[model samples]
Target: MLSDVLRSVRLTGSMLFLVDATTPWRSWAPQTEAFRRVVLPGSQHMVSYHVVTRGRCWAGLRDAPPESFETGDVLVIPHGDAYFLANPPDARASYGPEEAVAFFRQMAAGELPSVVPEGGGGAQQTQFICGFLGCDRRPFNPVLASLPRMIHLRGATALDGAMRHLVDFALCELREPAPGGKDVQLRLAELMFIEVVRRCLTTMAATQAGWLAGLGEPMVARALTLLHGAPARHWTLAELATQAGASRSVLAERFVQFVGQPPMQYLIQWRMQLATRMLAEPGAKVSGVAAALGYQSESAFSRAFKKCAGAAPGGWRRQPSE
Candidate 1:
C-alpha cells in the first residue's frame, strides 16, 4: 500500500496555526517554498493544509473559485501554492508576507497555536486548524507528484470517521498543551495527512491517470509495493512480474500505461532520488550509497545520478540548496 511507501520516505509534520476567526475574515498563506529557512528548515518540499474544525469558510488558490468548506472539512495544498481562506468567499483582506514572516518568528520563539486577529477585531467565530507536512523531495515522492495542486475533502463525505476522529484529537491536543504535546501533535499531523491521502485514493476514479491511480490496479500496485519495500535489491522484470502475479509483457504494458515508465527506468529514477538524499547527509560517502542502491561501482552510480539529477552526486551534495 501507499502507506508503506510513506513510512519508507519518512514524512514529518507540525501544526502551523490553530486559527479562530469570525465573519468578514480572510487570510492568505504563501507558498511553503518561502518558509524553508524558518519552518521545517532544510525541507526540500513542504505541504500546507487546513482543517475546518468549526463553521464554514471558502478556500482556493490565487484567482480560482474558492471552494466552500464546513466543519470537519480538510483542504490540502500539496504544491505549497499561495492560497486564501475566508468567510463569505469574497473577502478582500489577506495576510501578507510580512505577517507570514512574523508568524514563523513567533513559532520559532516557542509560541505555537498563535492566535491572530482577523476582520479588524470582532468576536472569534469561525474556527480552523492550519498546519504543514514536510518530507524529502528526493527519493521519489510519488504522493506529491500524484496529488493535484489542491485537494478539497469535504467534511461530510470525503473524509471518513477515522479522519474526523484524528482531526478532533488534534484539535484537543492543540487546545490543551500537555507534556510531550508537540511530539503527539506532530505525529497526529502526519497520520492525518496519510489518512487524507488514503481517503483520496479510495475515491479516486479509475480513469484518473497518476501514481495514485496506478495503485488501484492489482499488478501495478503489487509491483510498486515490492519495489518500494526493497529498493536496494537488484530486480529484473521477470522477478518483479512473477512476484506481482503477472506475465512480464503484461506487467510492463500496464506499468508503463499507468506509471508512465518502464519498471527498470522507474527503479533507476527511484534509486537516484534515494542517492541524492543519502549524499545530502553529512559524512555520507558515494561508494556507500552506490553499493546500498545495488550499483556495482561508484562510477556507474555517478553516471546514473547525473542523468537523473542533472549533476554528479558530489556536486549535488555541494550545492547549497536542492
Candidate 2:
C-alpha cells in the first residue's frame, strides 16, 4: 500500500531555518500525531505538505517518488502536486476519488479515521501534519523544471539527525505559547527545508542523471565550481570549455541536457541565486555583492541581475527576501 510504502520511506530517515519574524500558527501537531496527507490526481502542480509533530505519513510523486515519512521527518513536495498518504497498511483500499473527497470532508469535520481505524488493526496510530508548498509559476523555475514531479529522500541519513533535533526543538517551542513561538516555528520550517534540499542535492550528486549528475561531473562540476567560486571572471565559452576540459559544443550540449541550461546561462542564473542570498543578509551591500561576483561596477551588475532576476539589486535587497 502507498501509505505503508511511505511509512517505510519515512521510517528510514530523519530530517532547519530562516527567521522571517512572523507570527507562528496558533496550533501545532506532529505529522505523526496529528496531520492529513491528501493524494491529488493527474498532472496538477501542487505539493501536499505535512508537519509531522506526532506520527507518520506517505508522499508520492508522478515520477521519482519518495520513501515514507515519519516523526522528525519533514516532506517537501516542491511542485505542490497531489500524492497519497494513508495510515492503513493497504494504500489501495484507502484510495479512490470518492474516498478522497470523503476523507477530506471527514478531516474537515474532525472525523477522518486514523491510520489504525477501529477494529481494523492493532498497529500503533500515526499522526500527520498537513499544509501547502507554493510559489508563482512564471518566468520559469529552472530548478523545478529539471526536477521530476516527485522526490523523496529518507530522513535516516547521518546528516538529517541535526535536522530531526531542530524539528523536535521547534515542537517544544510551539507547545509553549510565547511571544515568538510562531516566529520560531516558521524559521525552523525554513531550516528544515534547507536541510532536505542539501540531502537531495547530495543524492543527485550520486545519481546517473539529473542536476546532481551534471553538477558532479568533473568537467561540469569544474565549470560550475569556477563560476560559483569566481563569477567575476570574465568567462567566455572558450575559457569555460577549457576549464571544463570539453569542446564548446560538448560543454553546451551536456550542460543543457543534464544541468537543464547552457553553461553560460547556468552561470548567470547561479550568480543571481547567490547574489540574492547575499543581498538578504543584513548590512550586505549591493556593490559588495557585485564585486564578490566579479562585477566591477554596480551598474553593470545591476543590469545583468535585473535582466536575469527581473528586479533591481537594491529592490531585491530591500524586500523581506525569500
Candidate 3:
C-alpha cells in the first residue's frame, strides 16, 4: 500500500553529496520555492534532508531554538521551509537567499566537487551528506502531508543505528566511484529516505492524527490496505466494512477521523490519482482510462475527475504542471 502511494507520487531523488565544514560555519537551506528549480526542475514539491555521518551540528528553522545533533542523526525539512545547519545552531549565515540560489545552481550543474568543503579553515570539522528529493504534491500526497515541517531523529536508539549504517555504506560507494556508483547511490538515497519515513511512523505519538498515523490503527489500517490494494473494485460501504470486520458507522467515523474522508470518498481520490498517472502516458485516452479504473463511461470518469481535481480529465491531463 505504501509502495503504491510512493509510486503514484513520482518520487525523484537527486544531487546527493557529502559536505565537510569547518567550525563557525553555517549553511542555509533556502526556501524550497526559491531553490527547487535550481535543484530539481519541474518538480511540484521539494524536501531537503541531511544525514549526520560524522561530528556534531545544530539545526532548526530560522529564529527557532536550534537542536543539537551528532553523528548518526538526521534532520529533515519535509516541507522545504527555510532552515540552517551550523557548528553553533544560531551562527549567522555568511550568505542569504540570492547567494544560496547561486550555490544550489552551481552544485546542481556539477560545477562543484562531489565533496563540498566549506567554512573557516579552523581545525574543528563536521561532516554530513545532503540530499534533495522532489515529488508530486497536487491531486494527492498523504506521505508528505502527514509529516511536520521539521523532523529530528536522534542517534542514540535503534532507528539511529540502522540509519547510520545505511548512510555509511552509501557514503563509501560514493567515495570510490564504481562502474554503477551513481545508480547505486540514487537507489540508496531513496531507500534511506523511505527508512526515515518509516521511523517517523513507528515513533509517532498515539495522539497523532494523519494518514501515516492511521496505518497504526488496526481498523483504519485494514480499510486503507484494502482500498489501496484494489482501488478498481466497486466497493460499497457495507462490503468494505464487512471485509474490515467493522460496522459501517464505526468504519466511516474512524476513516474520517484518521484520513479526513470516508472509505468511498478515499477510493474516489485514490482512483483519480491512478487516473492522472495513466493519462500522462503517451497515447492514453480518456475512455480507456475510465474503463480501466471501473468507471462505466468516459463522461462519468470526467465528472469525478473534475470534482476531485477542479478540472476536467482532458484539461487536467493537458496541464503543463501535470
Candidate 4:
C-alpha cells in the first residue's frame, strides 16, 4: 500500500544546496501555498528538508514550540507549512516571507550559488543542506494525508547502520563536491526522506490513527492488502471479512476505526486514484480503463471520477497544468 501511494506521488526535480551560516542567523521557509507554484509550478506539493551536518540549531513550525536539533539531525516539512531554523533561537531573519519566496525562486532556477552564506558572520557557525522536493498530493495520496505537518528525526535512532553509512557518504560527497555529485545528492535526498518515513512507521504508537497506523494492525492490514492487491475484484463486506478471517461487523468497525472509512468506500477512492493514473498515461482509453478497473461501463467510471475528482476524464486530461 505504501509502495503504491509512493509510486503515485514521486519526488520530482529538487533544488539542493549547502547552507553555511554564522551565529545569530535565522531562515524562514515560506508556506507552500505562497511559493509552491512559484518554485515548482506544476508540482502539487512542495516538501522541504534540512540535514544537519556540522552544528546544532533550533527548528520547527513557525508558531510551534522550538525544537533543538544537533549534528546529524534531520528536520523535514512534509506538509509544506512555513518553518524556520535559527542558531540563537531568536535570531532575526534579514528577509521576510515574501523575500524568502523570491529567494526560493532564484534558488530553484539555479541562479544562486551552491553554498549560500547567511547570518551575521559571527564566529560560531552552523551548517546544513537545504533541499526541496516536489510531489503530488491529489487524487488520493494516503501516505501524504497521514503525515504530520513537520517531522524532526534524530540520526542516532532513525538511521540503521546501512542508512547511516549512506548518509555519511552522501554528506561527505556534498561537502566535498566532485563530478556527478549533483546526481548523487539528488538520490541521497530522496532516500533520506524515505528512511525518515520508514522510521516513523516503525515507531508509531498503537493509539495512532490513519493509513500508516492501520498498516500496523493485523486485521486492518489484512483487509487493506486484499483491497489494494485486487482492487478490481467485486468485494463485499461478507467476502472481505471471510477472506480476512473476521466477522463482517467487526471488520467494518475496525476498518473505519483505523482507515476512517468503510472498506467499500475506500475501494471506490482507490479505484479513482488508479483511474486518474491511467487517464494521464499516453493513449489511454476511458473505456479500457473503466473495464480494467471493474466498472460496468465507461459512463459509470466517468460519473465516479467526476464525483471524486470534480471533472470528467476527458476534461481532466485536457485541463491545463497548474
Candidate 5:
C-alpha cells in the first residue's frame, strides 16, 4: 500500500553532483522551485538531498543556525527550500540563485564529476553527494505534504547502512562516469528516497497528527491500506471499518481524529485525485474514467471533479498540462 502511494506520486530521482570542496568553502543551493525546469524538468515538486560522504560541514536553511553534518550523515530538504552549506557555520559567504543556476547549467553541459572549489577558496576539506528527487505534487502527495522542511538523519541506525550503501554506489558511479552511470544514480536516488521515507515513518512519534501518523495507527493504517489498495471500489464506512477490524463508530472517530476527515470524504477526494491522473492518459475517456472511479455516470463524475478540482473533467483533460 505504501509502495502504491509512492508509485502514484510518480517519483523520479536525478543526481546533482558529488561536490568536494576545500574550506573556506561556502555556497547556497537555491530552492529547487527556482530551477525546476533546468534541474528536474516537468516535476511538480523537487526534493534536494546531501549525503556527507567525507569530512564535515555546516548545513541549514539560510536564515537559521547551521547544523553540523559529519561523514555518513544525510541531509534532506523535503520542500526543496534554499539552504546554506559552509565549512564554518557562520561564514558570511555569498552564492546567489543566478550563480547557482549558471553553475548547474555548466555542469549539465558535460562537466566531469570532480572537486570544484567553491567560490570561498579555503583549505579545510569537505565532500558531499548531492542529488534531487522529483515527484508529482498535483492530485495528491501525502508523503511530501506530511514531512518537515528539513530532516537530518545521522548514520547511526540499521537504516543508515542501506542508505549509505546507496549513496556510496551512486557516488562511485558519478565519480567514474561509466556507461549507464546516469541511470544507476537515478535509480539509486529513488531507492534512497524511499528508504529515507520508510526510516522517517518508523521513527515518527505516535503523537504526530498527519497522514504519515495516521498510517502508523493499527486501525487507521488498515483503513488506509484498503483505501489505497482499492480506490476504485465503492466502499462504505461500515465496510471499511469491518475490513479494518473495528466498528463503524470507532473507525469514524479515530479516522477523523488522525486523518482530519471522515472516511467517505477522504475517499471522495482520493478518488478525484486518481481520476485526474487517469483522465490525463493519452486515450482516456470521460465515461471510462467515471465508471472506473465508481461514478455511475459522466455527468456525476463531472460534478464531483469540478467540486474537487475547480474544473470539469473535460476542461481539466483539455488543459495544456497538469
Candidate 6:
C-alpha cells in the first residue's frame, strides 16, 4: 500500500521537506487574540501545511474565517504564502503588530498564559506546535490542486495515533542537540505531511466528496503499488491490468475514473518525477538513473525527461541543485 502511494506521489514531484514545530524557535502562547505568522520565502509554493502537537489554535486564509485546530491535527494552507495563526476566530482583523511581536518575544522568554479567550463563543488558553510542509507544484500533486484553501484535521479520532507520534518525533528531533538534528526534523516533517495527506485522502471520500474520491478505490491503490514498486520496469496496459486483477479495458476505465489518468500516462509522468529526483541527488548520474528506471539507454531517458522537465538530463544536471 505504501509503495503505491510513494510511486503515485513521485508523479507530481521528487522531494518532500519537513519542519518541526516543536523546535524551540516555534514555541509560542497567544496573548492578545492574534495570529502568528511563519514565513517561508523559499518554499516551493505547491503546498504549506502545519501539524499540531501541544494544544489548540486557528489558521486564517483568504475568504475564510480562522478555523480551529487541536493536538494531533494537521492544517494544510496551500501556497505557503503569508497566513495567520490565531487563538480565536474573532482575533482576526484586530491584532496589533507590535503586540504580536511582543507576545512572540514573551513566549520565547518562557512566559505562560492561562485562560485564552475564544472568539464568538468561549474563552480558553491554547497551546500548539506547528510546522511547514514543502513540495513541488506539478504533474502529480493531485492532492494540492484539488484541496480546499483550508483543511482541518480532527484530532482525538482514530487517525490521531500515528499523527501524534509524528508530531512528537518531530518535536524531539527539532529539540535534539545532535548535529544535523534540525535538517533531520525537517525531512521527517515532510514525510509526515505526505502521510497526513494520504490519511486525509482516505477519509475525504466520505467527508469531502470531491476530487480525492478516486484515491479510495482498491484498483487504483493496486496500480499505485505497482508503479512505486518498480518505476524502472517497462509497463504496458495488459501487464498493469493483469497485475491489478482487471481486464485491460476495465483497468483503463477504472484507472481513468480513480486516478484521473490512463495507466500508461501516469507511468510516464511518474518515471520523469523519479528521474528528476535522481538528477537532483548529489552523486547520481543520468545514465545510471536511466538504467535503474528501465530506460533502454540514456538518450531515450533524456528525451522523455526533457519533454516533461523542459530540459535535457545533462542540462538539468548542470543546473543549480535544490
lDDT of each: 0.79, 0.52, 0.83, 0.82, 0.78, 0.58
Each prediction's total of clashing residue pairs, residues at least 3 apart in sequence or on different chains, is 1, 40, 0, 0, 3, 10
Which regions of candidate 4 are displaced past 4 Å? 205-207
Give me the displacement of residue 213 in model 6, in angstroms.
Answer: 4.7
* Candidate 3: regions farther than 4 A off: 158-162
Q: Give model 5's TM-score versus the native structure.
A: 0.91
Local distance difference test, candidate 4: 0.82
Better of 1 and 3 by lDDT: 3
Q: What ranking of all candidate models by TM-score puts the best one first?
A: 3, 4, 5, 1, 6, 2
> Which residue pairs collide in model 3, if any?
none
Candidate 2: tens digits of C-alpha lDDT, residues 190-306: 455545555666676666465556656677767766666666678999999888799999888877767777877766776776677577679999999999988889999899899
TM-score of each: 0.90, 0.54, 0.93, 0.92, 0.91, 0.68
lDDT of 5 at 301: 86
lDDT of 5 by residue, 1-322 (tens): 6687787777887555778777777867787767777866656788888778888998998767899888877788998788977888767666667878877666644454534556466767888877777887766577877788888877674236677677667767777777876677778778888888887777663756667888888999999999988888889999999999999999999998877788888888778878877887899999999999888889998998899878888887765432
* lDDT (Cα) of model 6: 0.58
TM-score of 4: 0.92
Give the per-residue lDDT of model 6 (tens digit) for 33-75.
2322222222234354566555566665645666767766667
Q: What would the per-residue lDDT of candidate 4 be over residues 132-234, giving only the tens digit for each residue?
A: 7788776677777777788787868665655677667766775687887767777776776776667767766265778888888899899999999999999
> How far is each candidate from the true structure, as Cα RMSD in Å?
2.4, 11.2, 1.9, 2.0, 2.3, 7.5
> Comparing 2 and 5 by TM-score, which wins?
5
lDDT of 2 at 214: 67
